[model samples]
Target: MGTLNLSFQIQTLYMSPSSPSFNTFTISLTTNRKKSNCSRFSLSMGNPNDTHTKLVPGAAGFLLQDVPHFTDYLDHLPIVVHKESARGVHFRRAGPRQKVYFKSDDVNACIVTCGGLCPGLNTVIREIVCGLYHMYGVRKVLGIDGGYRGFYAKNTITLTPKFVDDIHKRGGTILGTSRGGHDSVKIVDRIQDRGINQVYIIGGDGTHKGAAVIFEEIRRRGLKVAVAGIPKTIDNDIPVIDKSFGFDTVVEEAQRAIKAAHVESESMGNGIGLVKLMGRYCGFIAMYATLASRDVDCCLIPESPFYLEGKGGLYEYIGKRLKQNGHMVIVIAEGAGQELLSKSLQSVDQQDASGNKLLQDVGLWISHKIKEHFAKKRMPINLKYIDPTYMIRAIPSIASDNVYCTLLAHGAVHGAMAGYTGFTVGPVNGRHAYIPFNRIIEKQNKVVITDRMWARLLSSTNQPSFLKPRDIAEAKKEKYPANGILDGKIVKTMSMN
Candidate 1:
């Protein structure tokens, strides 16, 4: 009995009975370089007795196999109900002693996808579901629809290994997710009723905050439920963890797109191709692709201002590149700045149940601005911008990273069963590892950006700095061409329209 279901939030259909419900969609997400359908899950109905070696990819074409299996640790993996778990007796004394027990048969766990879409969400979902059912002997893994809102909703789906069997390599999640809308009352009621023993959340910065809140609520309820969060998102903004899952895939795909775009841009001679990559608040996607595709002439990010006052910044840079360099390929983040911020801010007035405003589309606005800029400044300097937004976001072409997500998910299951609720299994220092829950639940992980990295990105024409990891700084500056005016003596000037 396969029970496969996707978690795509209801698209303005309002299927849930809740009022003023959060958009329960992507608009509330912090903008990032995005691509593909990015739709977001699956598992077997039951676990097989055979031990299989799942190969998950690490950075730079490395593969991690087997991973560590936690099924043998019966102490951590238990069959329980009502907070009581099944444990074998070791030795008993003649004197009377208190016997403690835990009730299992419960699933008060919450998992979510946050920030932006990443490949392998479905695989992660599968490992989680299978681990709970087969090893822990638990029942019912609730899939929260539309991210944080689903946790508070009249919306959720019951998951099993059978439910997620076919989605190992698919893009997005079977449980739909959103950025905010973590209402305590609604969430508390649901967990209390379902007897959820633990909660696991998957996301980056914006989404993880909600995880912290829900974890706190679990404690306040006097329930023994443990809370855990998995660090997801292509942006990889999460700190403390070695690397958030999905980032490598995003960077890899973005690099391919840039390579393809570069070949096309070079063929056109003197044309400027502006390819938008995924990092909205950050530049991981764009910058990494720029580093990968040295052929790219320029890169832009939200951190660095490319278009100053719309008249002379990015437009001037692109114009100069076309006239002098003969061709250019620029990588930019979707959440990038443009001359069109305030205008769009006035147009959209929708809010989530939490009363937060929706974010605007900076990618489209930037595309329009670039078209208008080149059209007005220089004579039809051929300009093109490829929005790999949904393309990379929803990509299911290959499963190198999906396998890794599954392994991590499997590791998470081991972690959870080890009474290790509240920790996200992740890579540590380039190795497979676990980031405990204390940082996410009990403390605030600071969002830090360094001075040197910022300076290099601003000055370099090659790559955006924010996308690179804090431990490394490899992005180089880009060089732009200055067109020379020819009347009598050749003089450099902004190319006239």
Candidate 2:
């Protein structure tokens, strides 16, 4: 393998109204690569001279200092100071640029939503359409219906400010969505045929992978199309971002189910309430919901392993809690304790159309197990199980998520217009930045059991950690290395906040 060297300089100008002066800060980033399986850690762009003229209108007062230059970037590892090696990873800051590559009159943009339904999907779609029309004087915008297949199969819907005016008030996506319909060749061909120069893809991990393929194909064909992705996942699993779009809404909506479970359990004699939320590989939903509810006695997630039959296990903890409180509420992620289910049921693993594993209904399985365990002890228990998996994801976004979706959509639009390609837009460290597709899709972010947030959850619920000595050792190894390097790549510490 050969080393890939990249260098960029950022020029930031600070101006004060009273002082009538400005200060400039120039930061340079140079990275030296030795060995890595990941793709190039830089945002791809079109011709350097493509963007030479300022096209955005009605911003004459602050355009000179407000617009970010092409060289501006955000350091990926801001806290890490590698004194020995003059190498650092950085991402281009996402915002309006002084110069734009695509002329407003010549630009034709399209947006598509793929994967499962999520809260605020329509909010993102509406913002993209409105942002382009109102920000830049672009009039031609198309909505790709039915995901990737829509690029070639279905008819396109023309989007306007009036058409998507109140879409944010509605749930789900107006463009429609599907899974496992990616065909990069056909999609790019249709894009070329239709003269669409900008593409915005909104989806989760699998959908982002498909977007990466489409971007590569466009780049290979020497097309001028810019591909941008807005990460969307109800599970909050996408890495390198503060949180996914629908995550807050899902967490908020999940509280309704938890509240109902608490009410049902508290009303019945020797009552037990079990609520399952949406989390396939991560336990953020379950953990956060439990902490917010403050009524749960026990919480189970995939990151922490628990056995039912052993001492200090789930069964013993439940018995003790019920005996003390007379009623108890338990929360479990969808992916929690899958190995136990698999071994007990001896079922074969299956996958969905999007290559995701079809998870067994752990909510029902565990409820049955708890009933059997109490029955053997000649104990009477009334257990209420609530699975709000679909309900939480299908509802409209709350106030916070609606504002967040608007910012994300605008960031993506700015990047695409500035000729940045193969990137996703999201808040990194609370500031918006354009991240390469390879970075966000490299790994799924999971809830860190050893983090302070998990500790807080345990403290609030008074539940056992359900962790063994070996599990602790494994978690330590899984965290970011002390040297700020992992597998020959610089990585940020995992954060649950």
Candidate 3:
């Protein structure tokens, strides 16, 4: 790398003895002026008109320390970049920049939220509105009510900084939310009618899938519109992101459920506390809460399946704990161990509006089982079953979540104005970047059961490995009776003693 010389004029507060009338001093760099790379520069400070003023000794220390460097952008990249085939190497820095593709006065933006309510939803809305208007001079921002249906349903309110300034203090989306209504054609027609050039869709994977469809429809009509998403998976199941907006808040809120369960178990004589968390397909929320609370005795997640009635099963675990400690706390995700309790998905055929199969009631199901087993044994047991899924989802975000939502919104606005579409603002190795919807929804993110986080959680709870290494082999070798439950091999092991 070569060097470049640049000079700076500084207005110093101190007055020089020889030139008391001169308030400004000129600092000139003595280096190769034609070169591009200037890692270090030497400064020569003196009055402009007076050649008699000599350069101060060691004056370049403060001047050189304040100057910007050429390799500053490299620090933004990940510490360790996983090289795939080592072809077409490049660098991409994230954050808002001045250059944009859209004209500030002519730009029209639309904001829509979908799926369930989550913490930091209002904070994200406030930041996007503030960023578009204050940062990009965008004035015609509209907030869509409900989810994808808001596009064609003609439910919108004009968004202004004054209107959204106090929304971050409250929970839920100011524009409201809903599920389903992912009609791409109708939504695109509405977007065109309103002259909306940029659309910010905030929701989970299903909502992002809908946004992708809408973006495709816009392209099919040969229109120049931008569609971006802010991943709002409260369960933290979205792939490629370090953590979703509401995850930290959910972990903080789920701690209350654990606390309550612990208190109830201690109050009763030989009590068992069972708390259920929200995680339809993954168990990030449950796992994080268990790890954070530090009061839980056992935890079950969707990634790791467990038996209900077999040897060394959940019931036996609870019984052993009650005999040992007289009080126990158990945390289970709402989606965990469902196949062992509910009928096959094919046989039940129940689904919500988002086409997701309704999860079986794991919380109540386990409570009943624990009660029945203890009742059969003629043992007096008090088991508290608490489900705080909706309560945690409806609360406002904490300080950390508010900051995260602000950054995600800023990244979304920058990417949209830069003409990037069909992508969501997600973290790439802990730095914010635009990840395409296809890459994000390629496969649902789940907690790695073998990872260090799980190991740490197991050590904290001191629970036996319900899933032994030989359990898979033993499961495959075992035969199933035709009359018993046949959801999977795990269900076959749930035979009653």
lDDT of each: 0.53, 0.78, 0.73
lDDT of 2 by residue, 1-497 (tens): 33333332222222223443322222222333344223122332322442211111221111110112222232232221111121223345667866686789988999999999999999999999999999998999999999888987759999999999998888899999999978899999999899898999999999999998998888677777889999999899998777999888888898999999999999988899999988999999999888888888889999899999878889899889889999999999999999999899978879997999999999999999999999998989999999989999988999999999999999999888876777898875576777778777889989888888999999999988878899898997875411111111222222111
lDDT of 3 by residue, 1-497 (tens): 43444344433222223443213434444433333222222222233443112232223212110111111111122111112221111112346644566778988999999998999999999999999999989999999988788887777899999999889988888999999988888888898898888899999888888887886677567676878889998889886566889899999999998999999999999988899999988999988899899999999998888886778777788888889999999999999988877652333658888878887788898888789888998988999999998999898899999999999999888877765566687665455655656656756778777667888999999887688677556545543211100010000111111
Give the local distance difference test score of model 3.
0.73
For candidate 1, the TM-score is: 0.62
lDDT of 2 at 481: 15
- What's each prediction's TM-score? 0.62, 0.82, 0.77
Q: What are the per-residue Cα lDDT tens digits for candidate 1 across 1-497?
A: 22222222212211123442222231111111223221110111112441222211122111111112111111211111110111111110011112212224544455556545677777787878876777667786788788767756677788877888887657777787666566766776787776666677777655556655665565455455556566776766555444566666777778767877777777786676778776646666676666666777777665554443334456666667777778888777765663347654566566654333444666567767777766666566566667787778676524666666766776666555544333455654334444434343333222233444444444556433334343344222322112111011111122111
How far does residue 422 in candidate 3 sit from its true spot (Å)?
1.7
lDDT score of residue 470 within candidate 2: 92
- The worst-scoring run of ten residues by lDDT in candidate 3 lies at 484-493
Q: Model 1 Cα displacement at 286 (Å)?
A: 0.7
Please give the lDDT score at residue 438 for candidate 3: 64
- After superposition of all CA atoms, the RMSD between model 2 and the true structure is 10.4
Question: Judged by TM-score relative to the true structure, which candidate is superior, 1 or 3?
Answer: 3
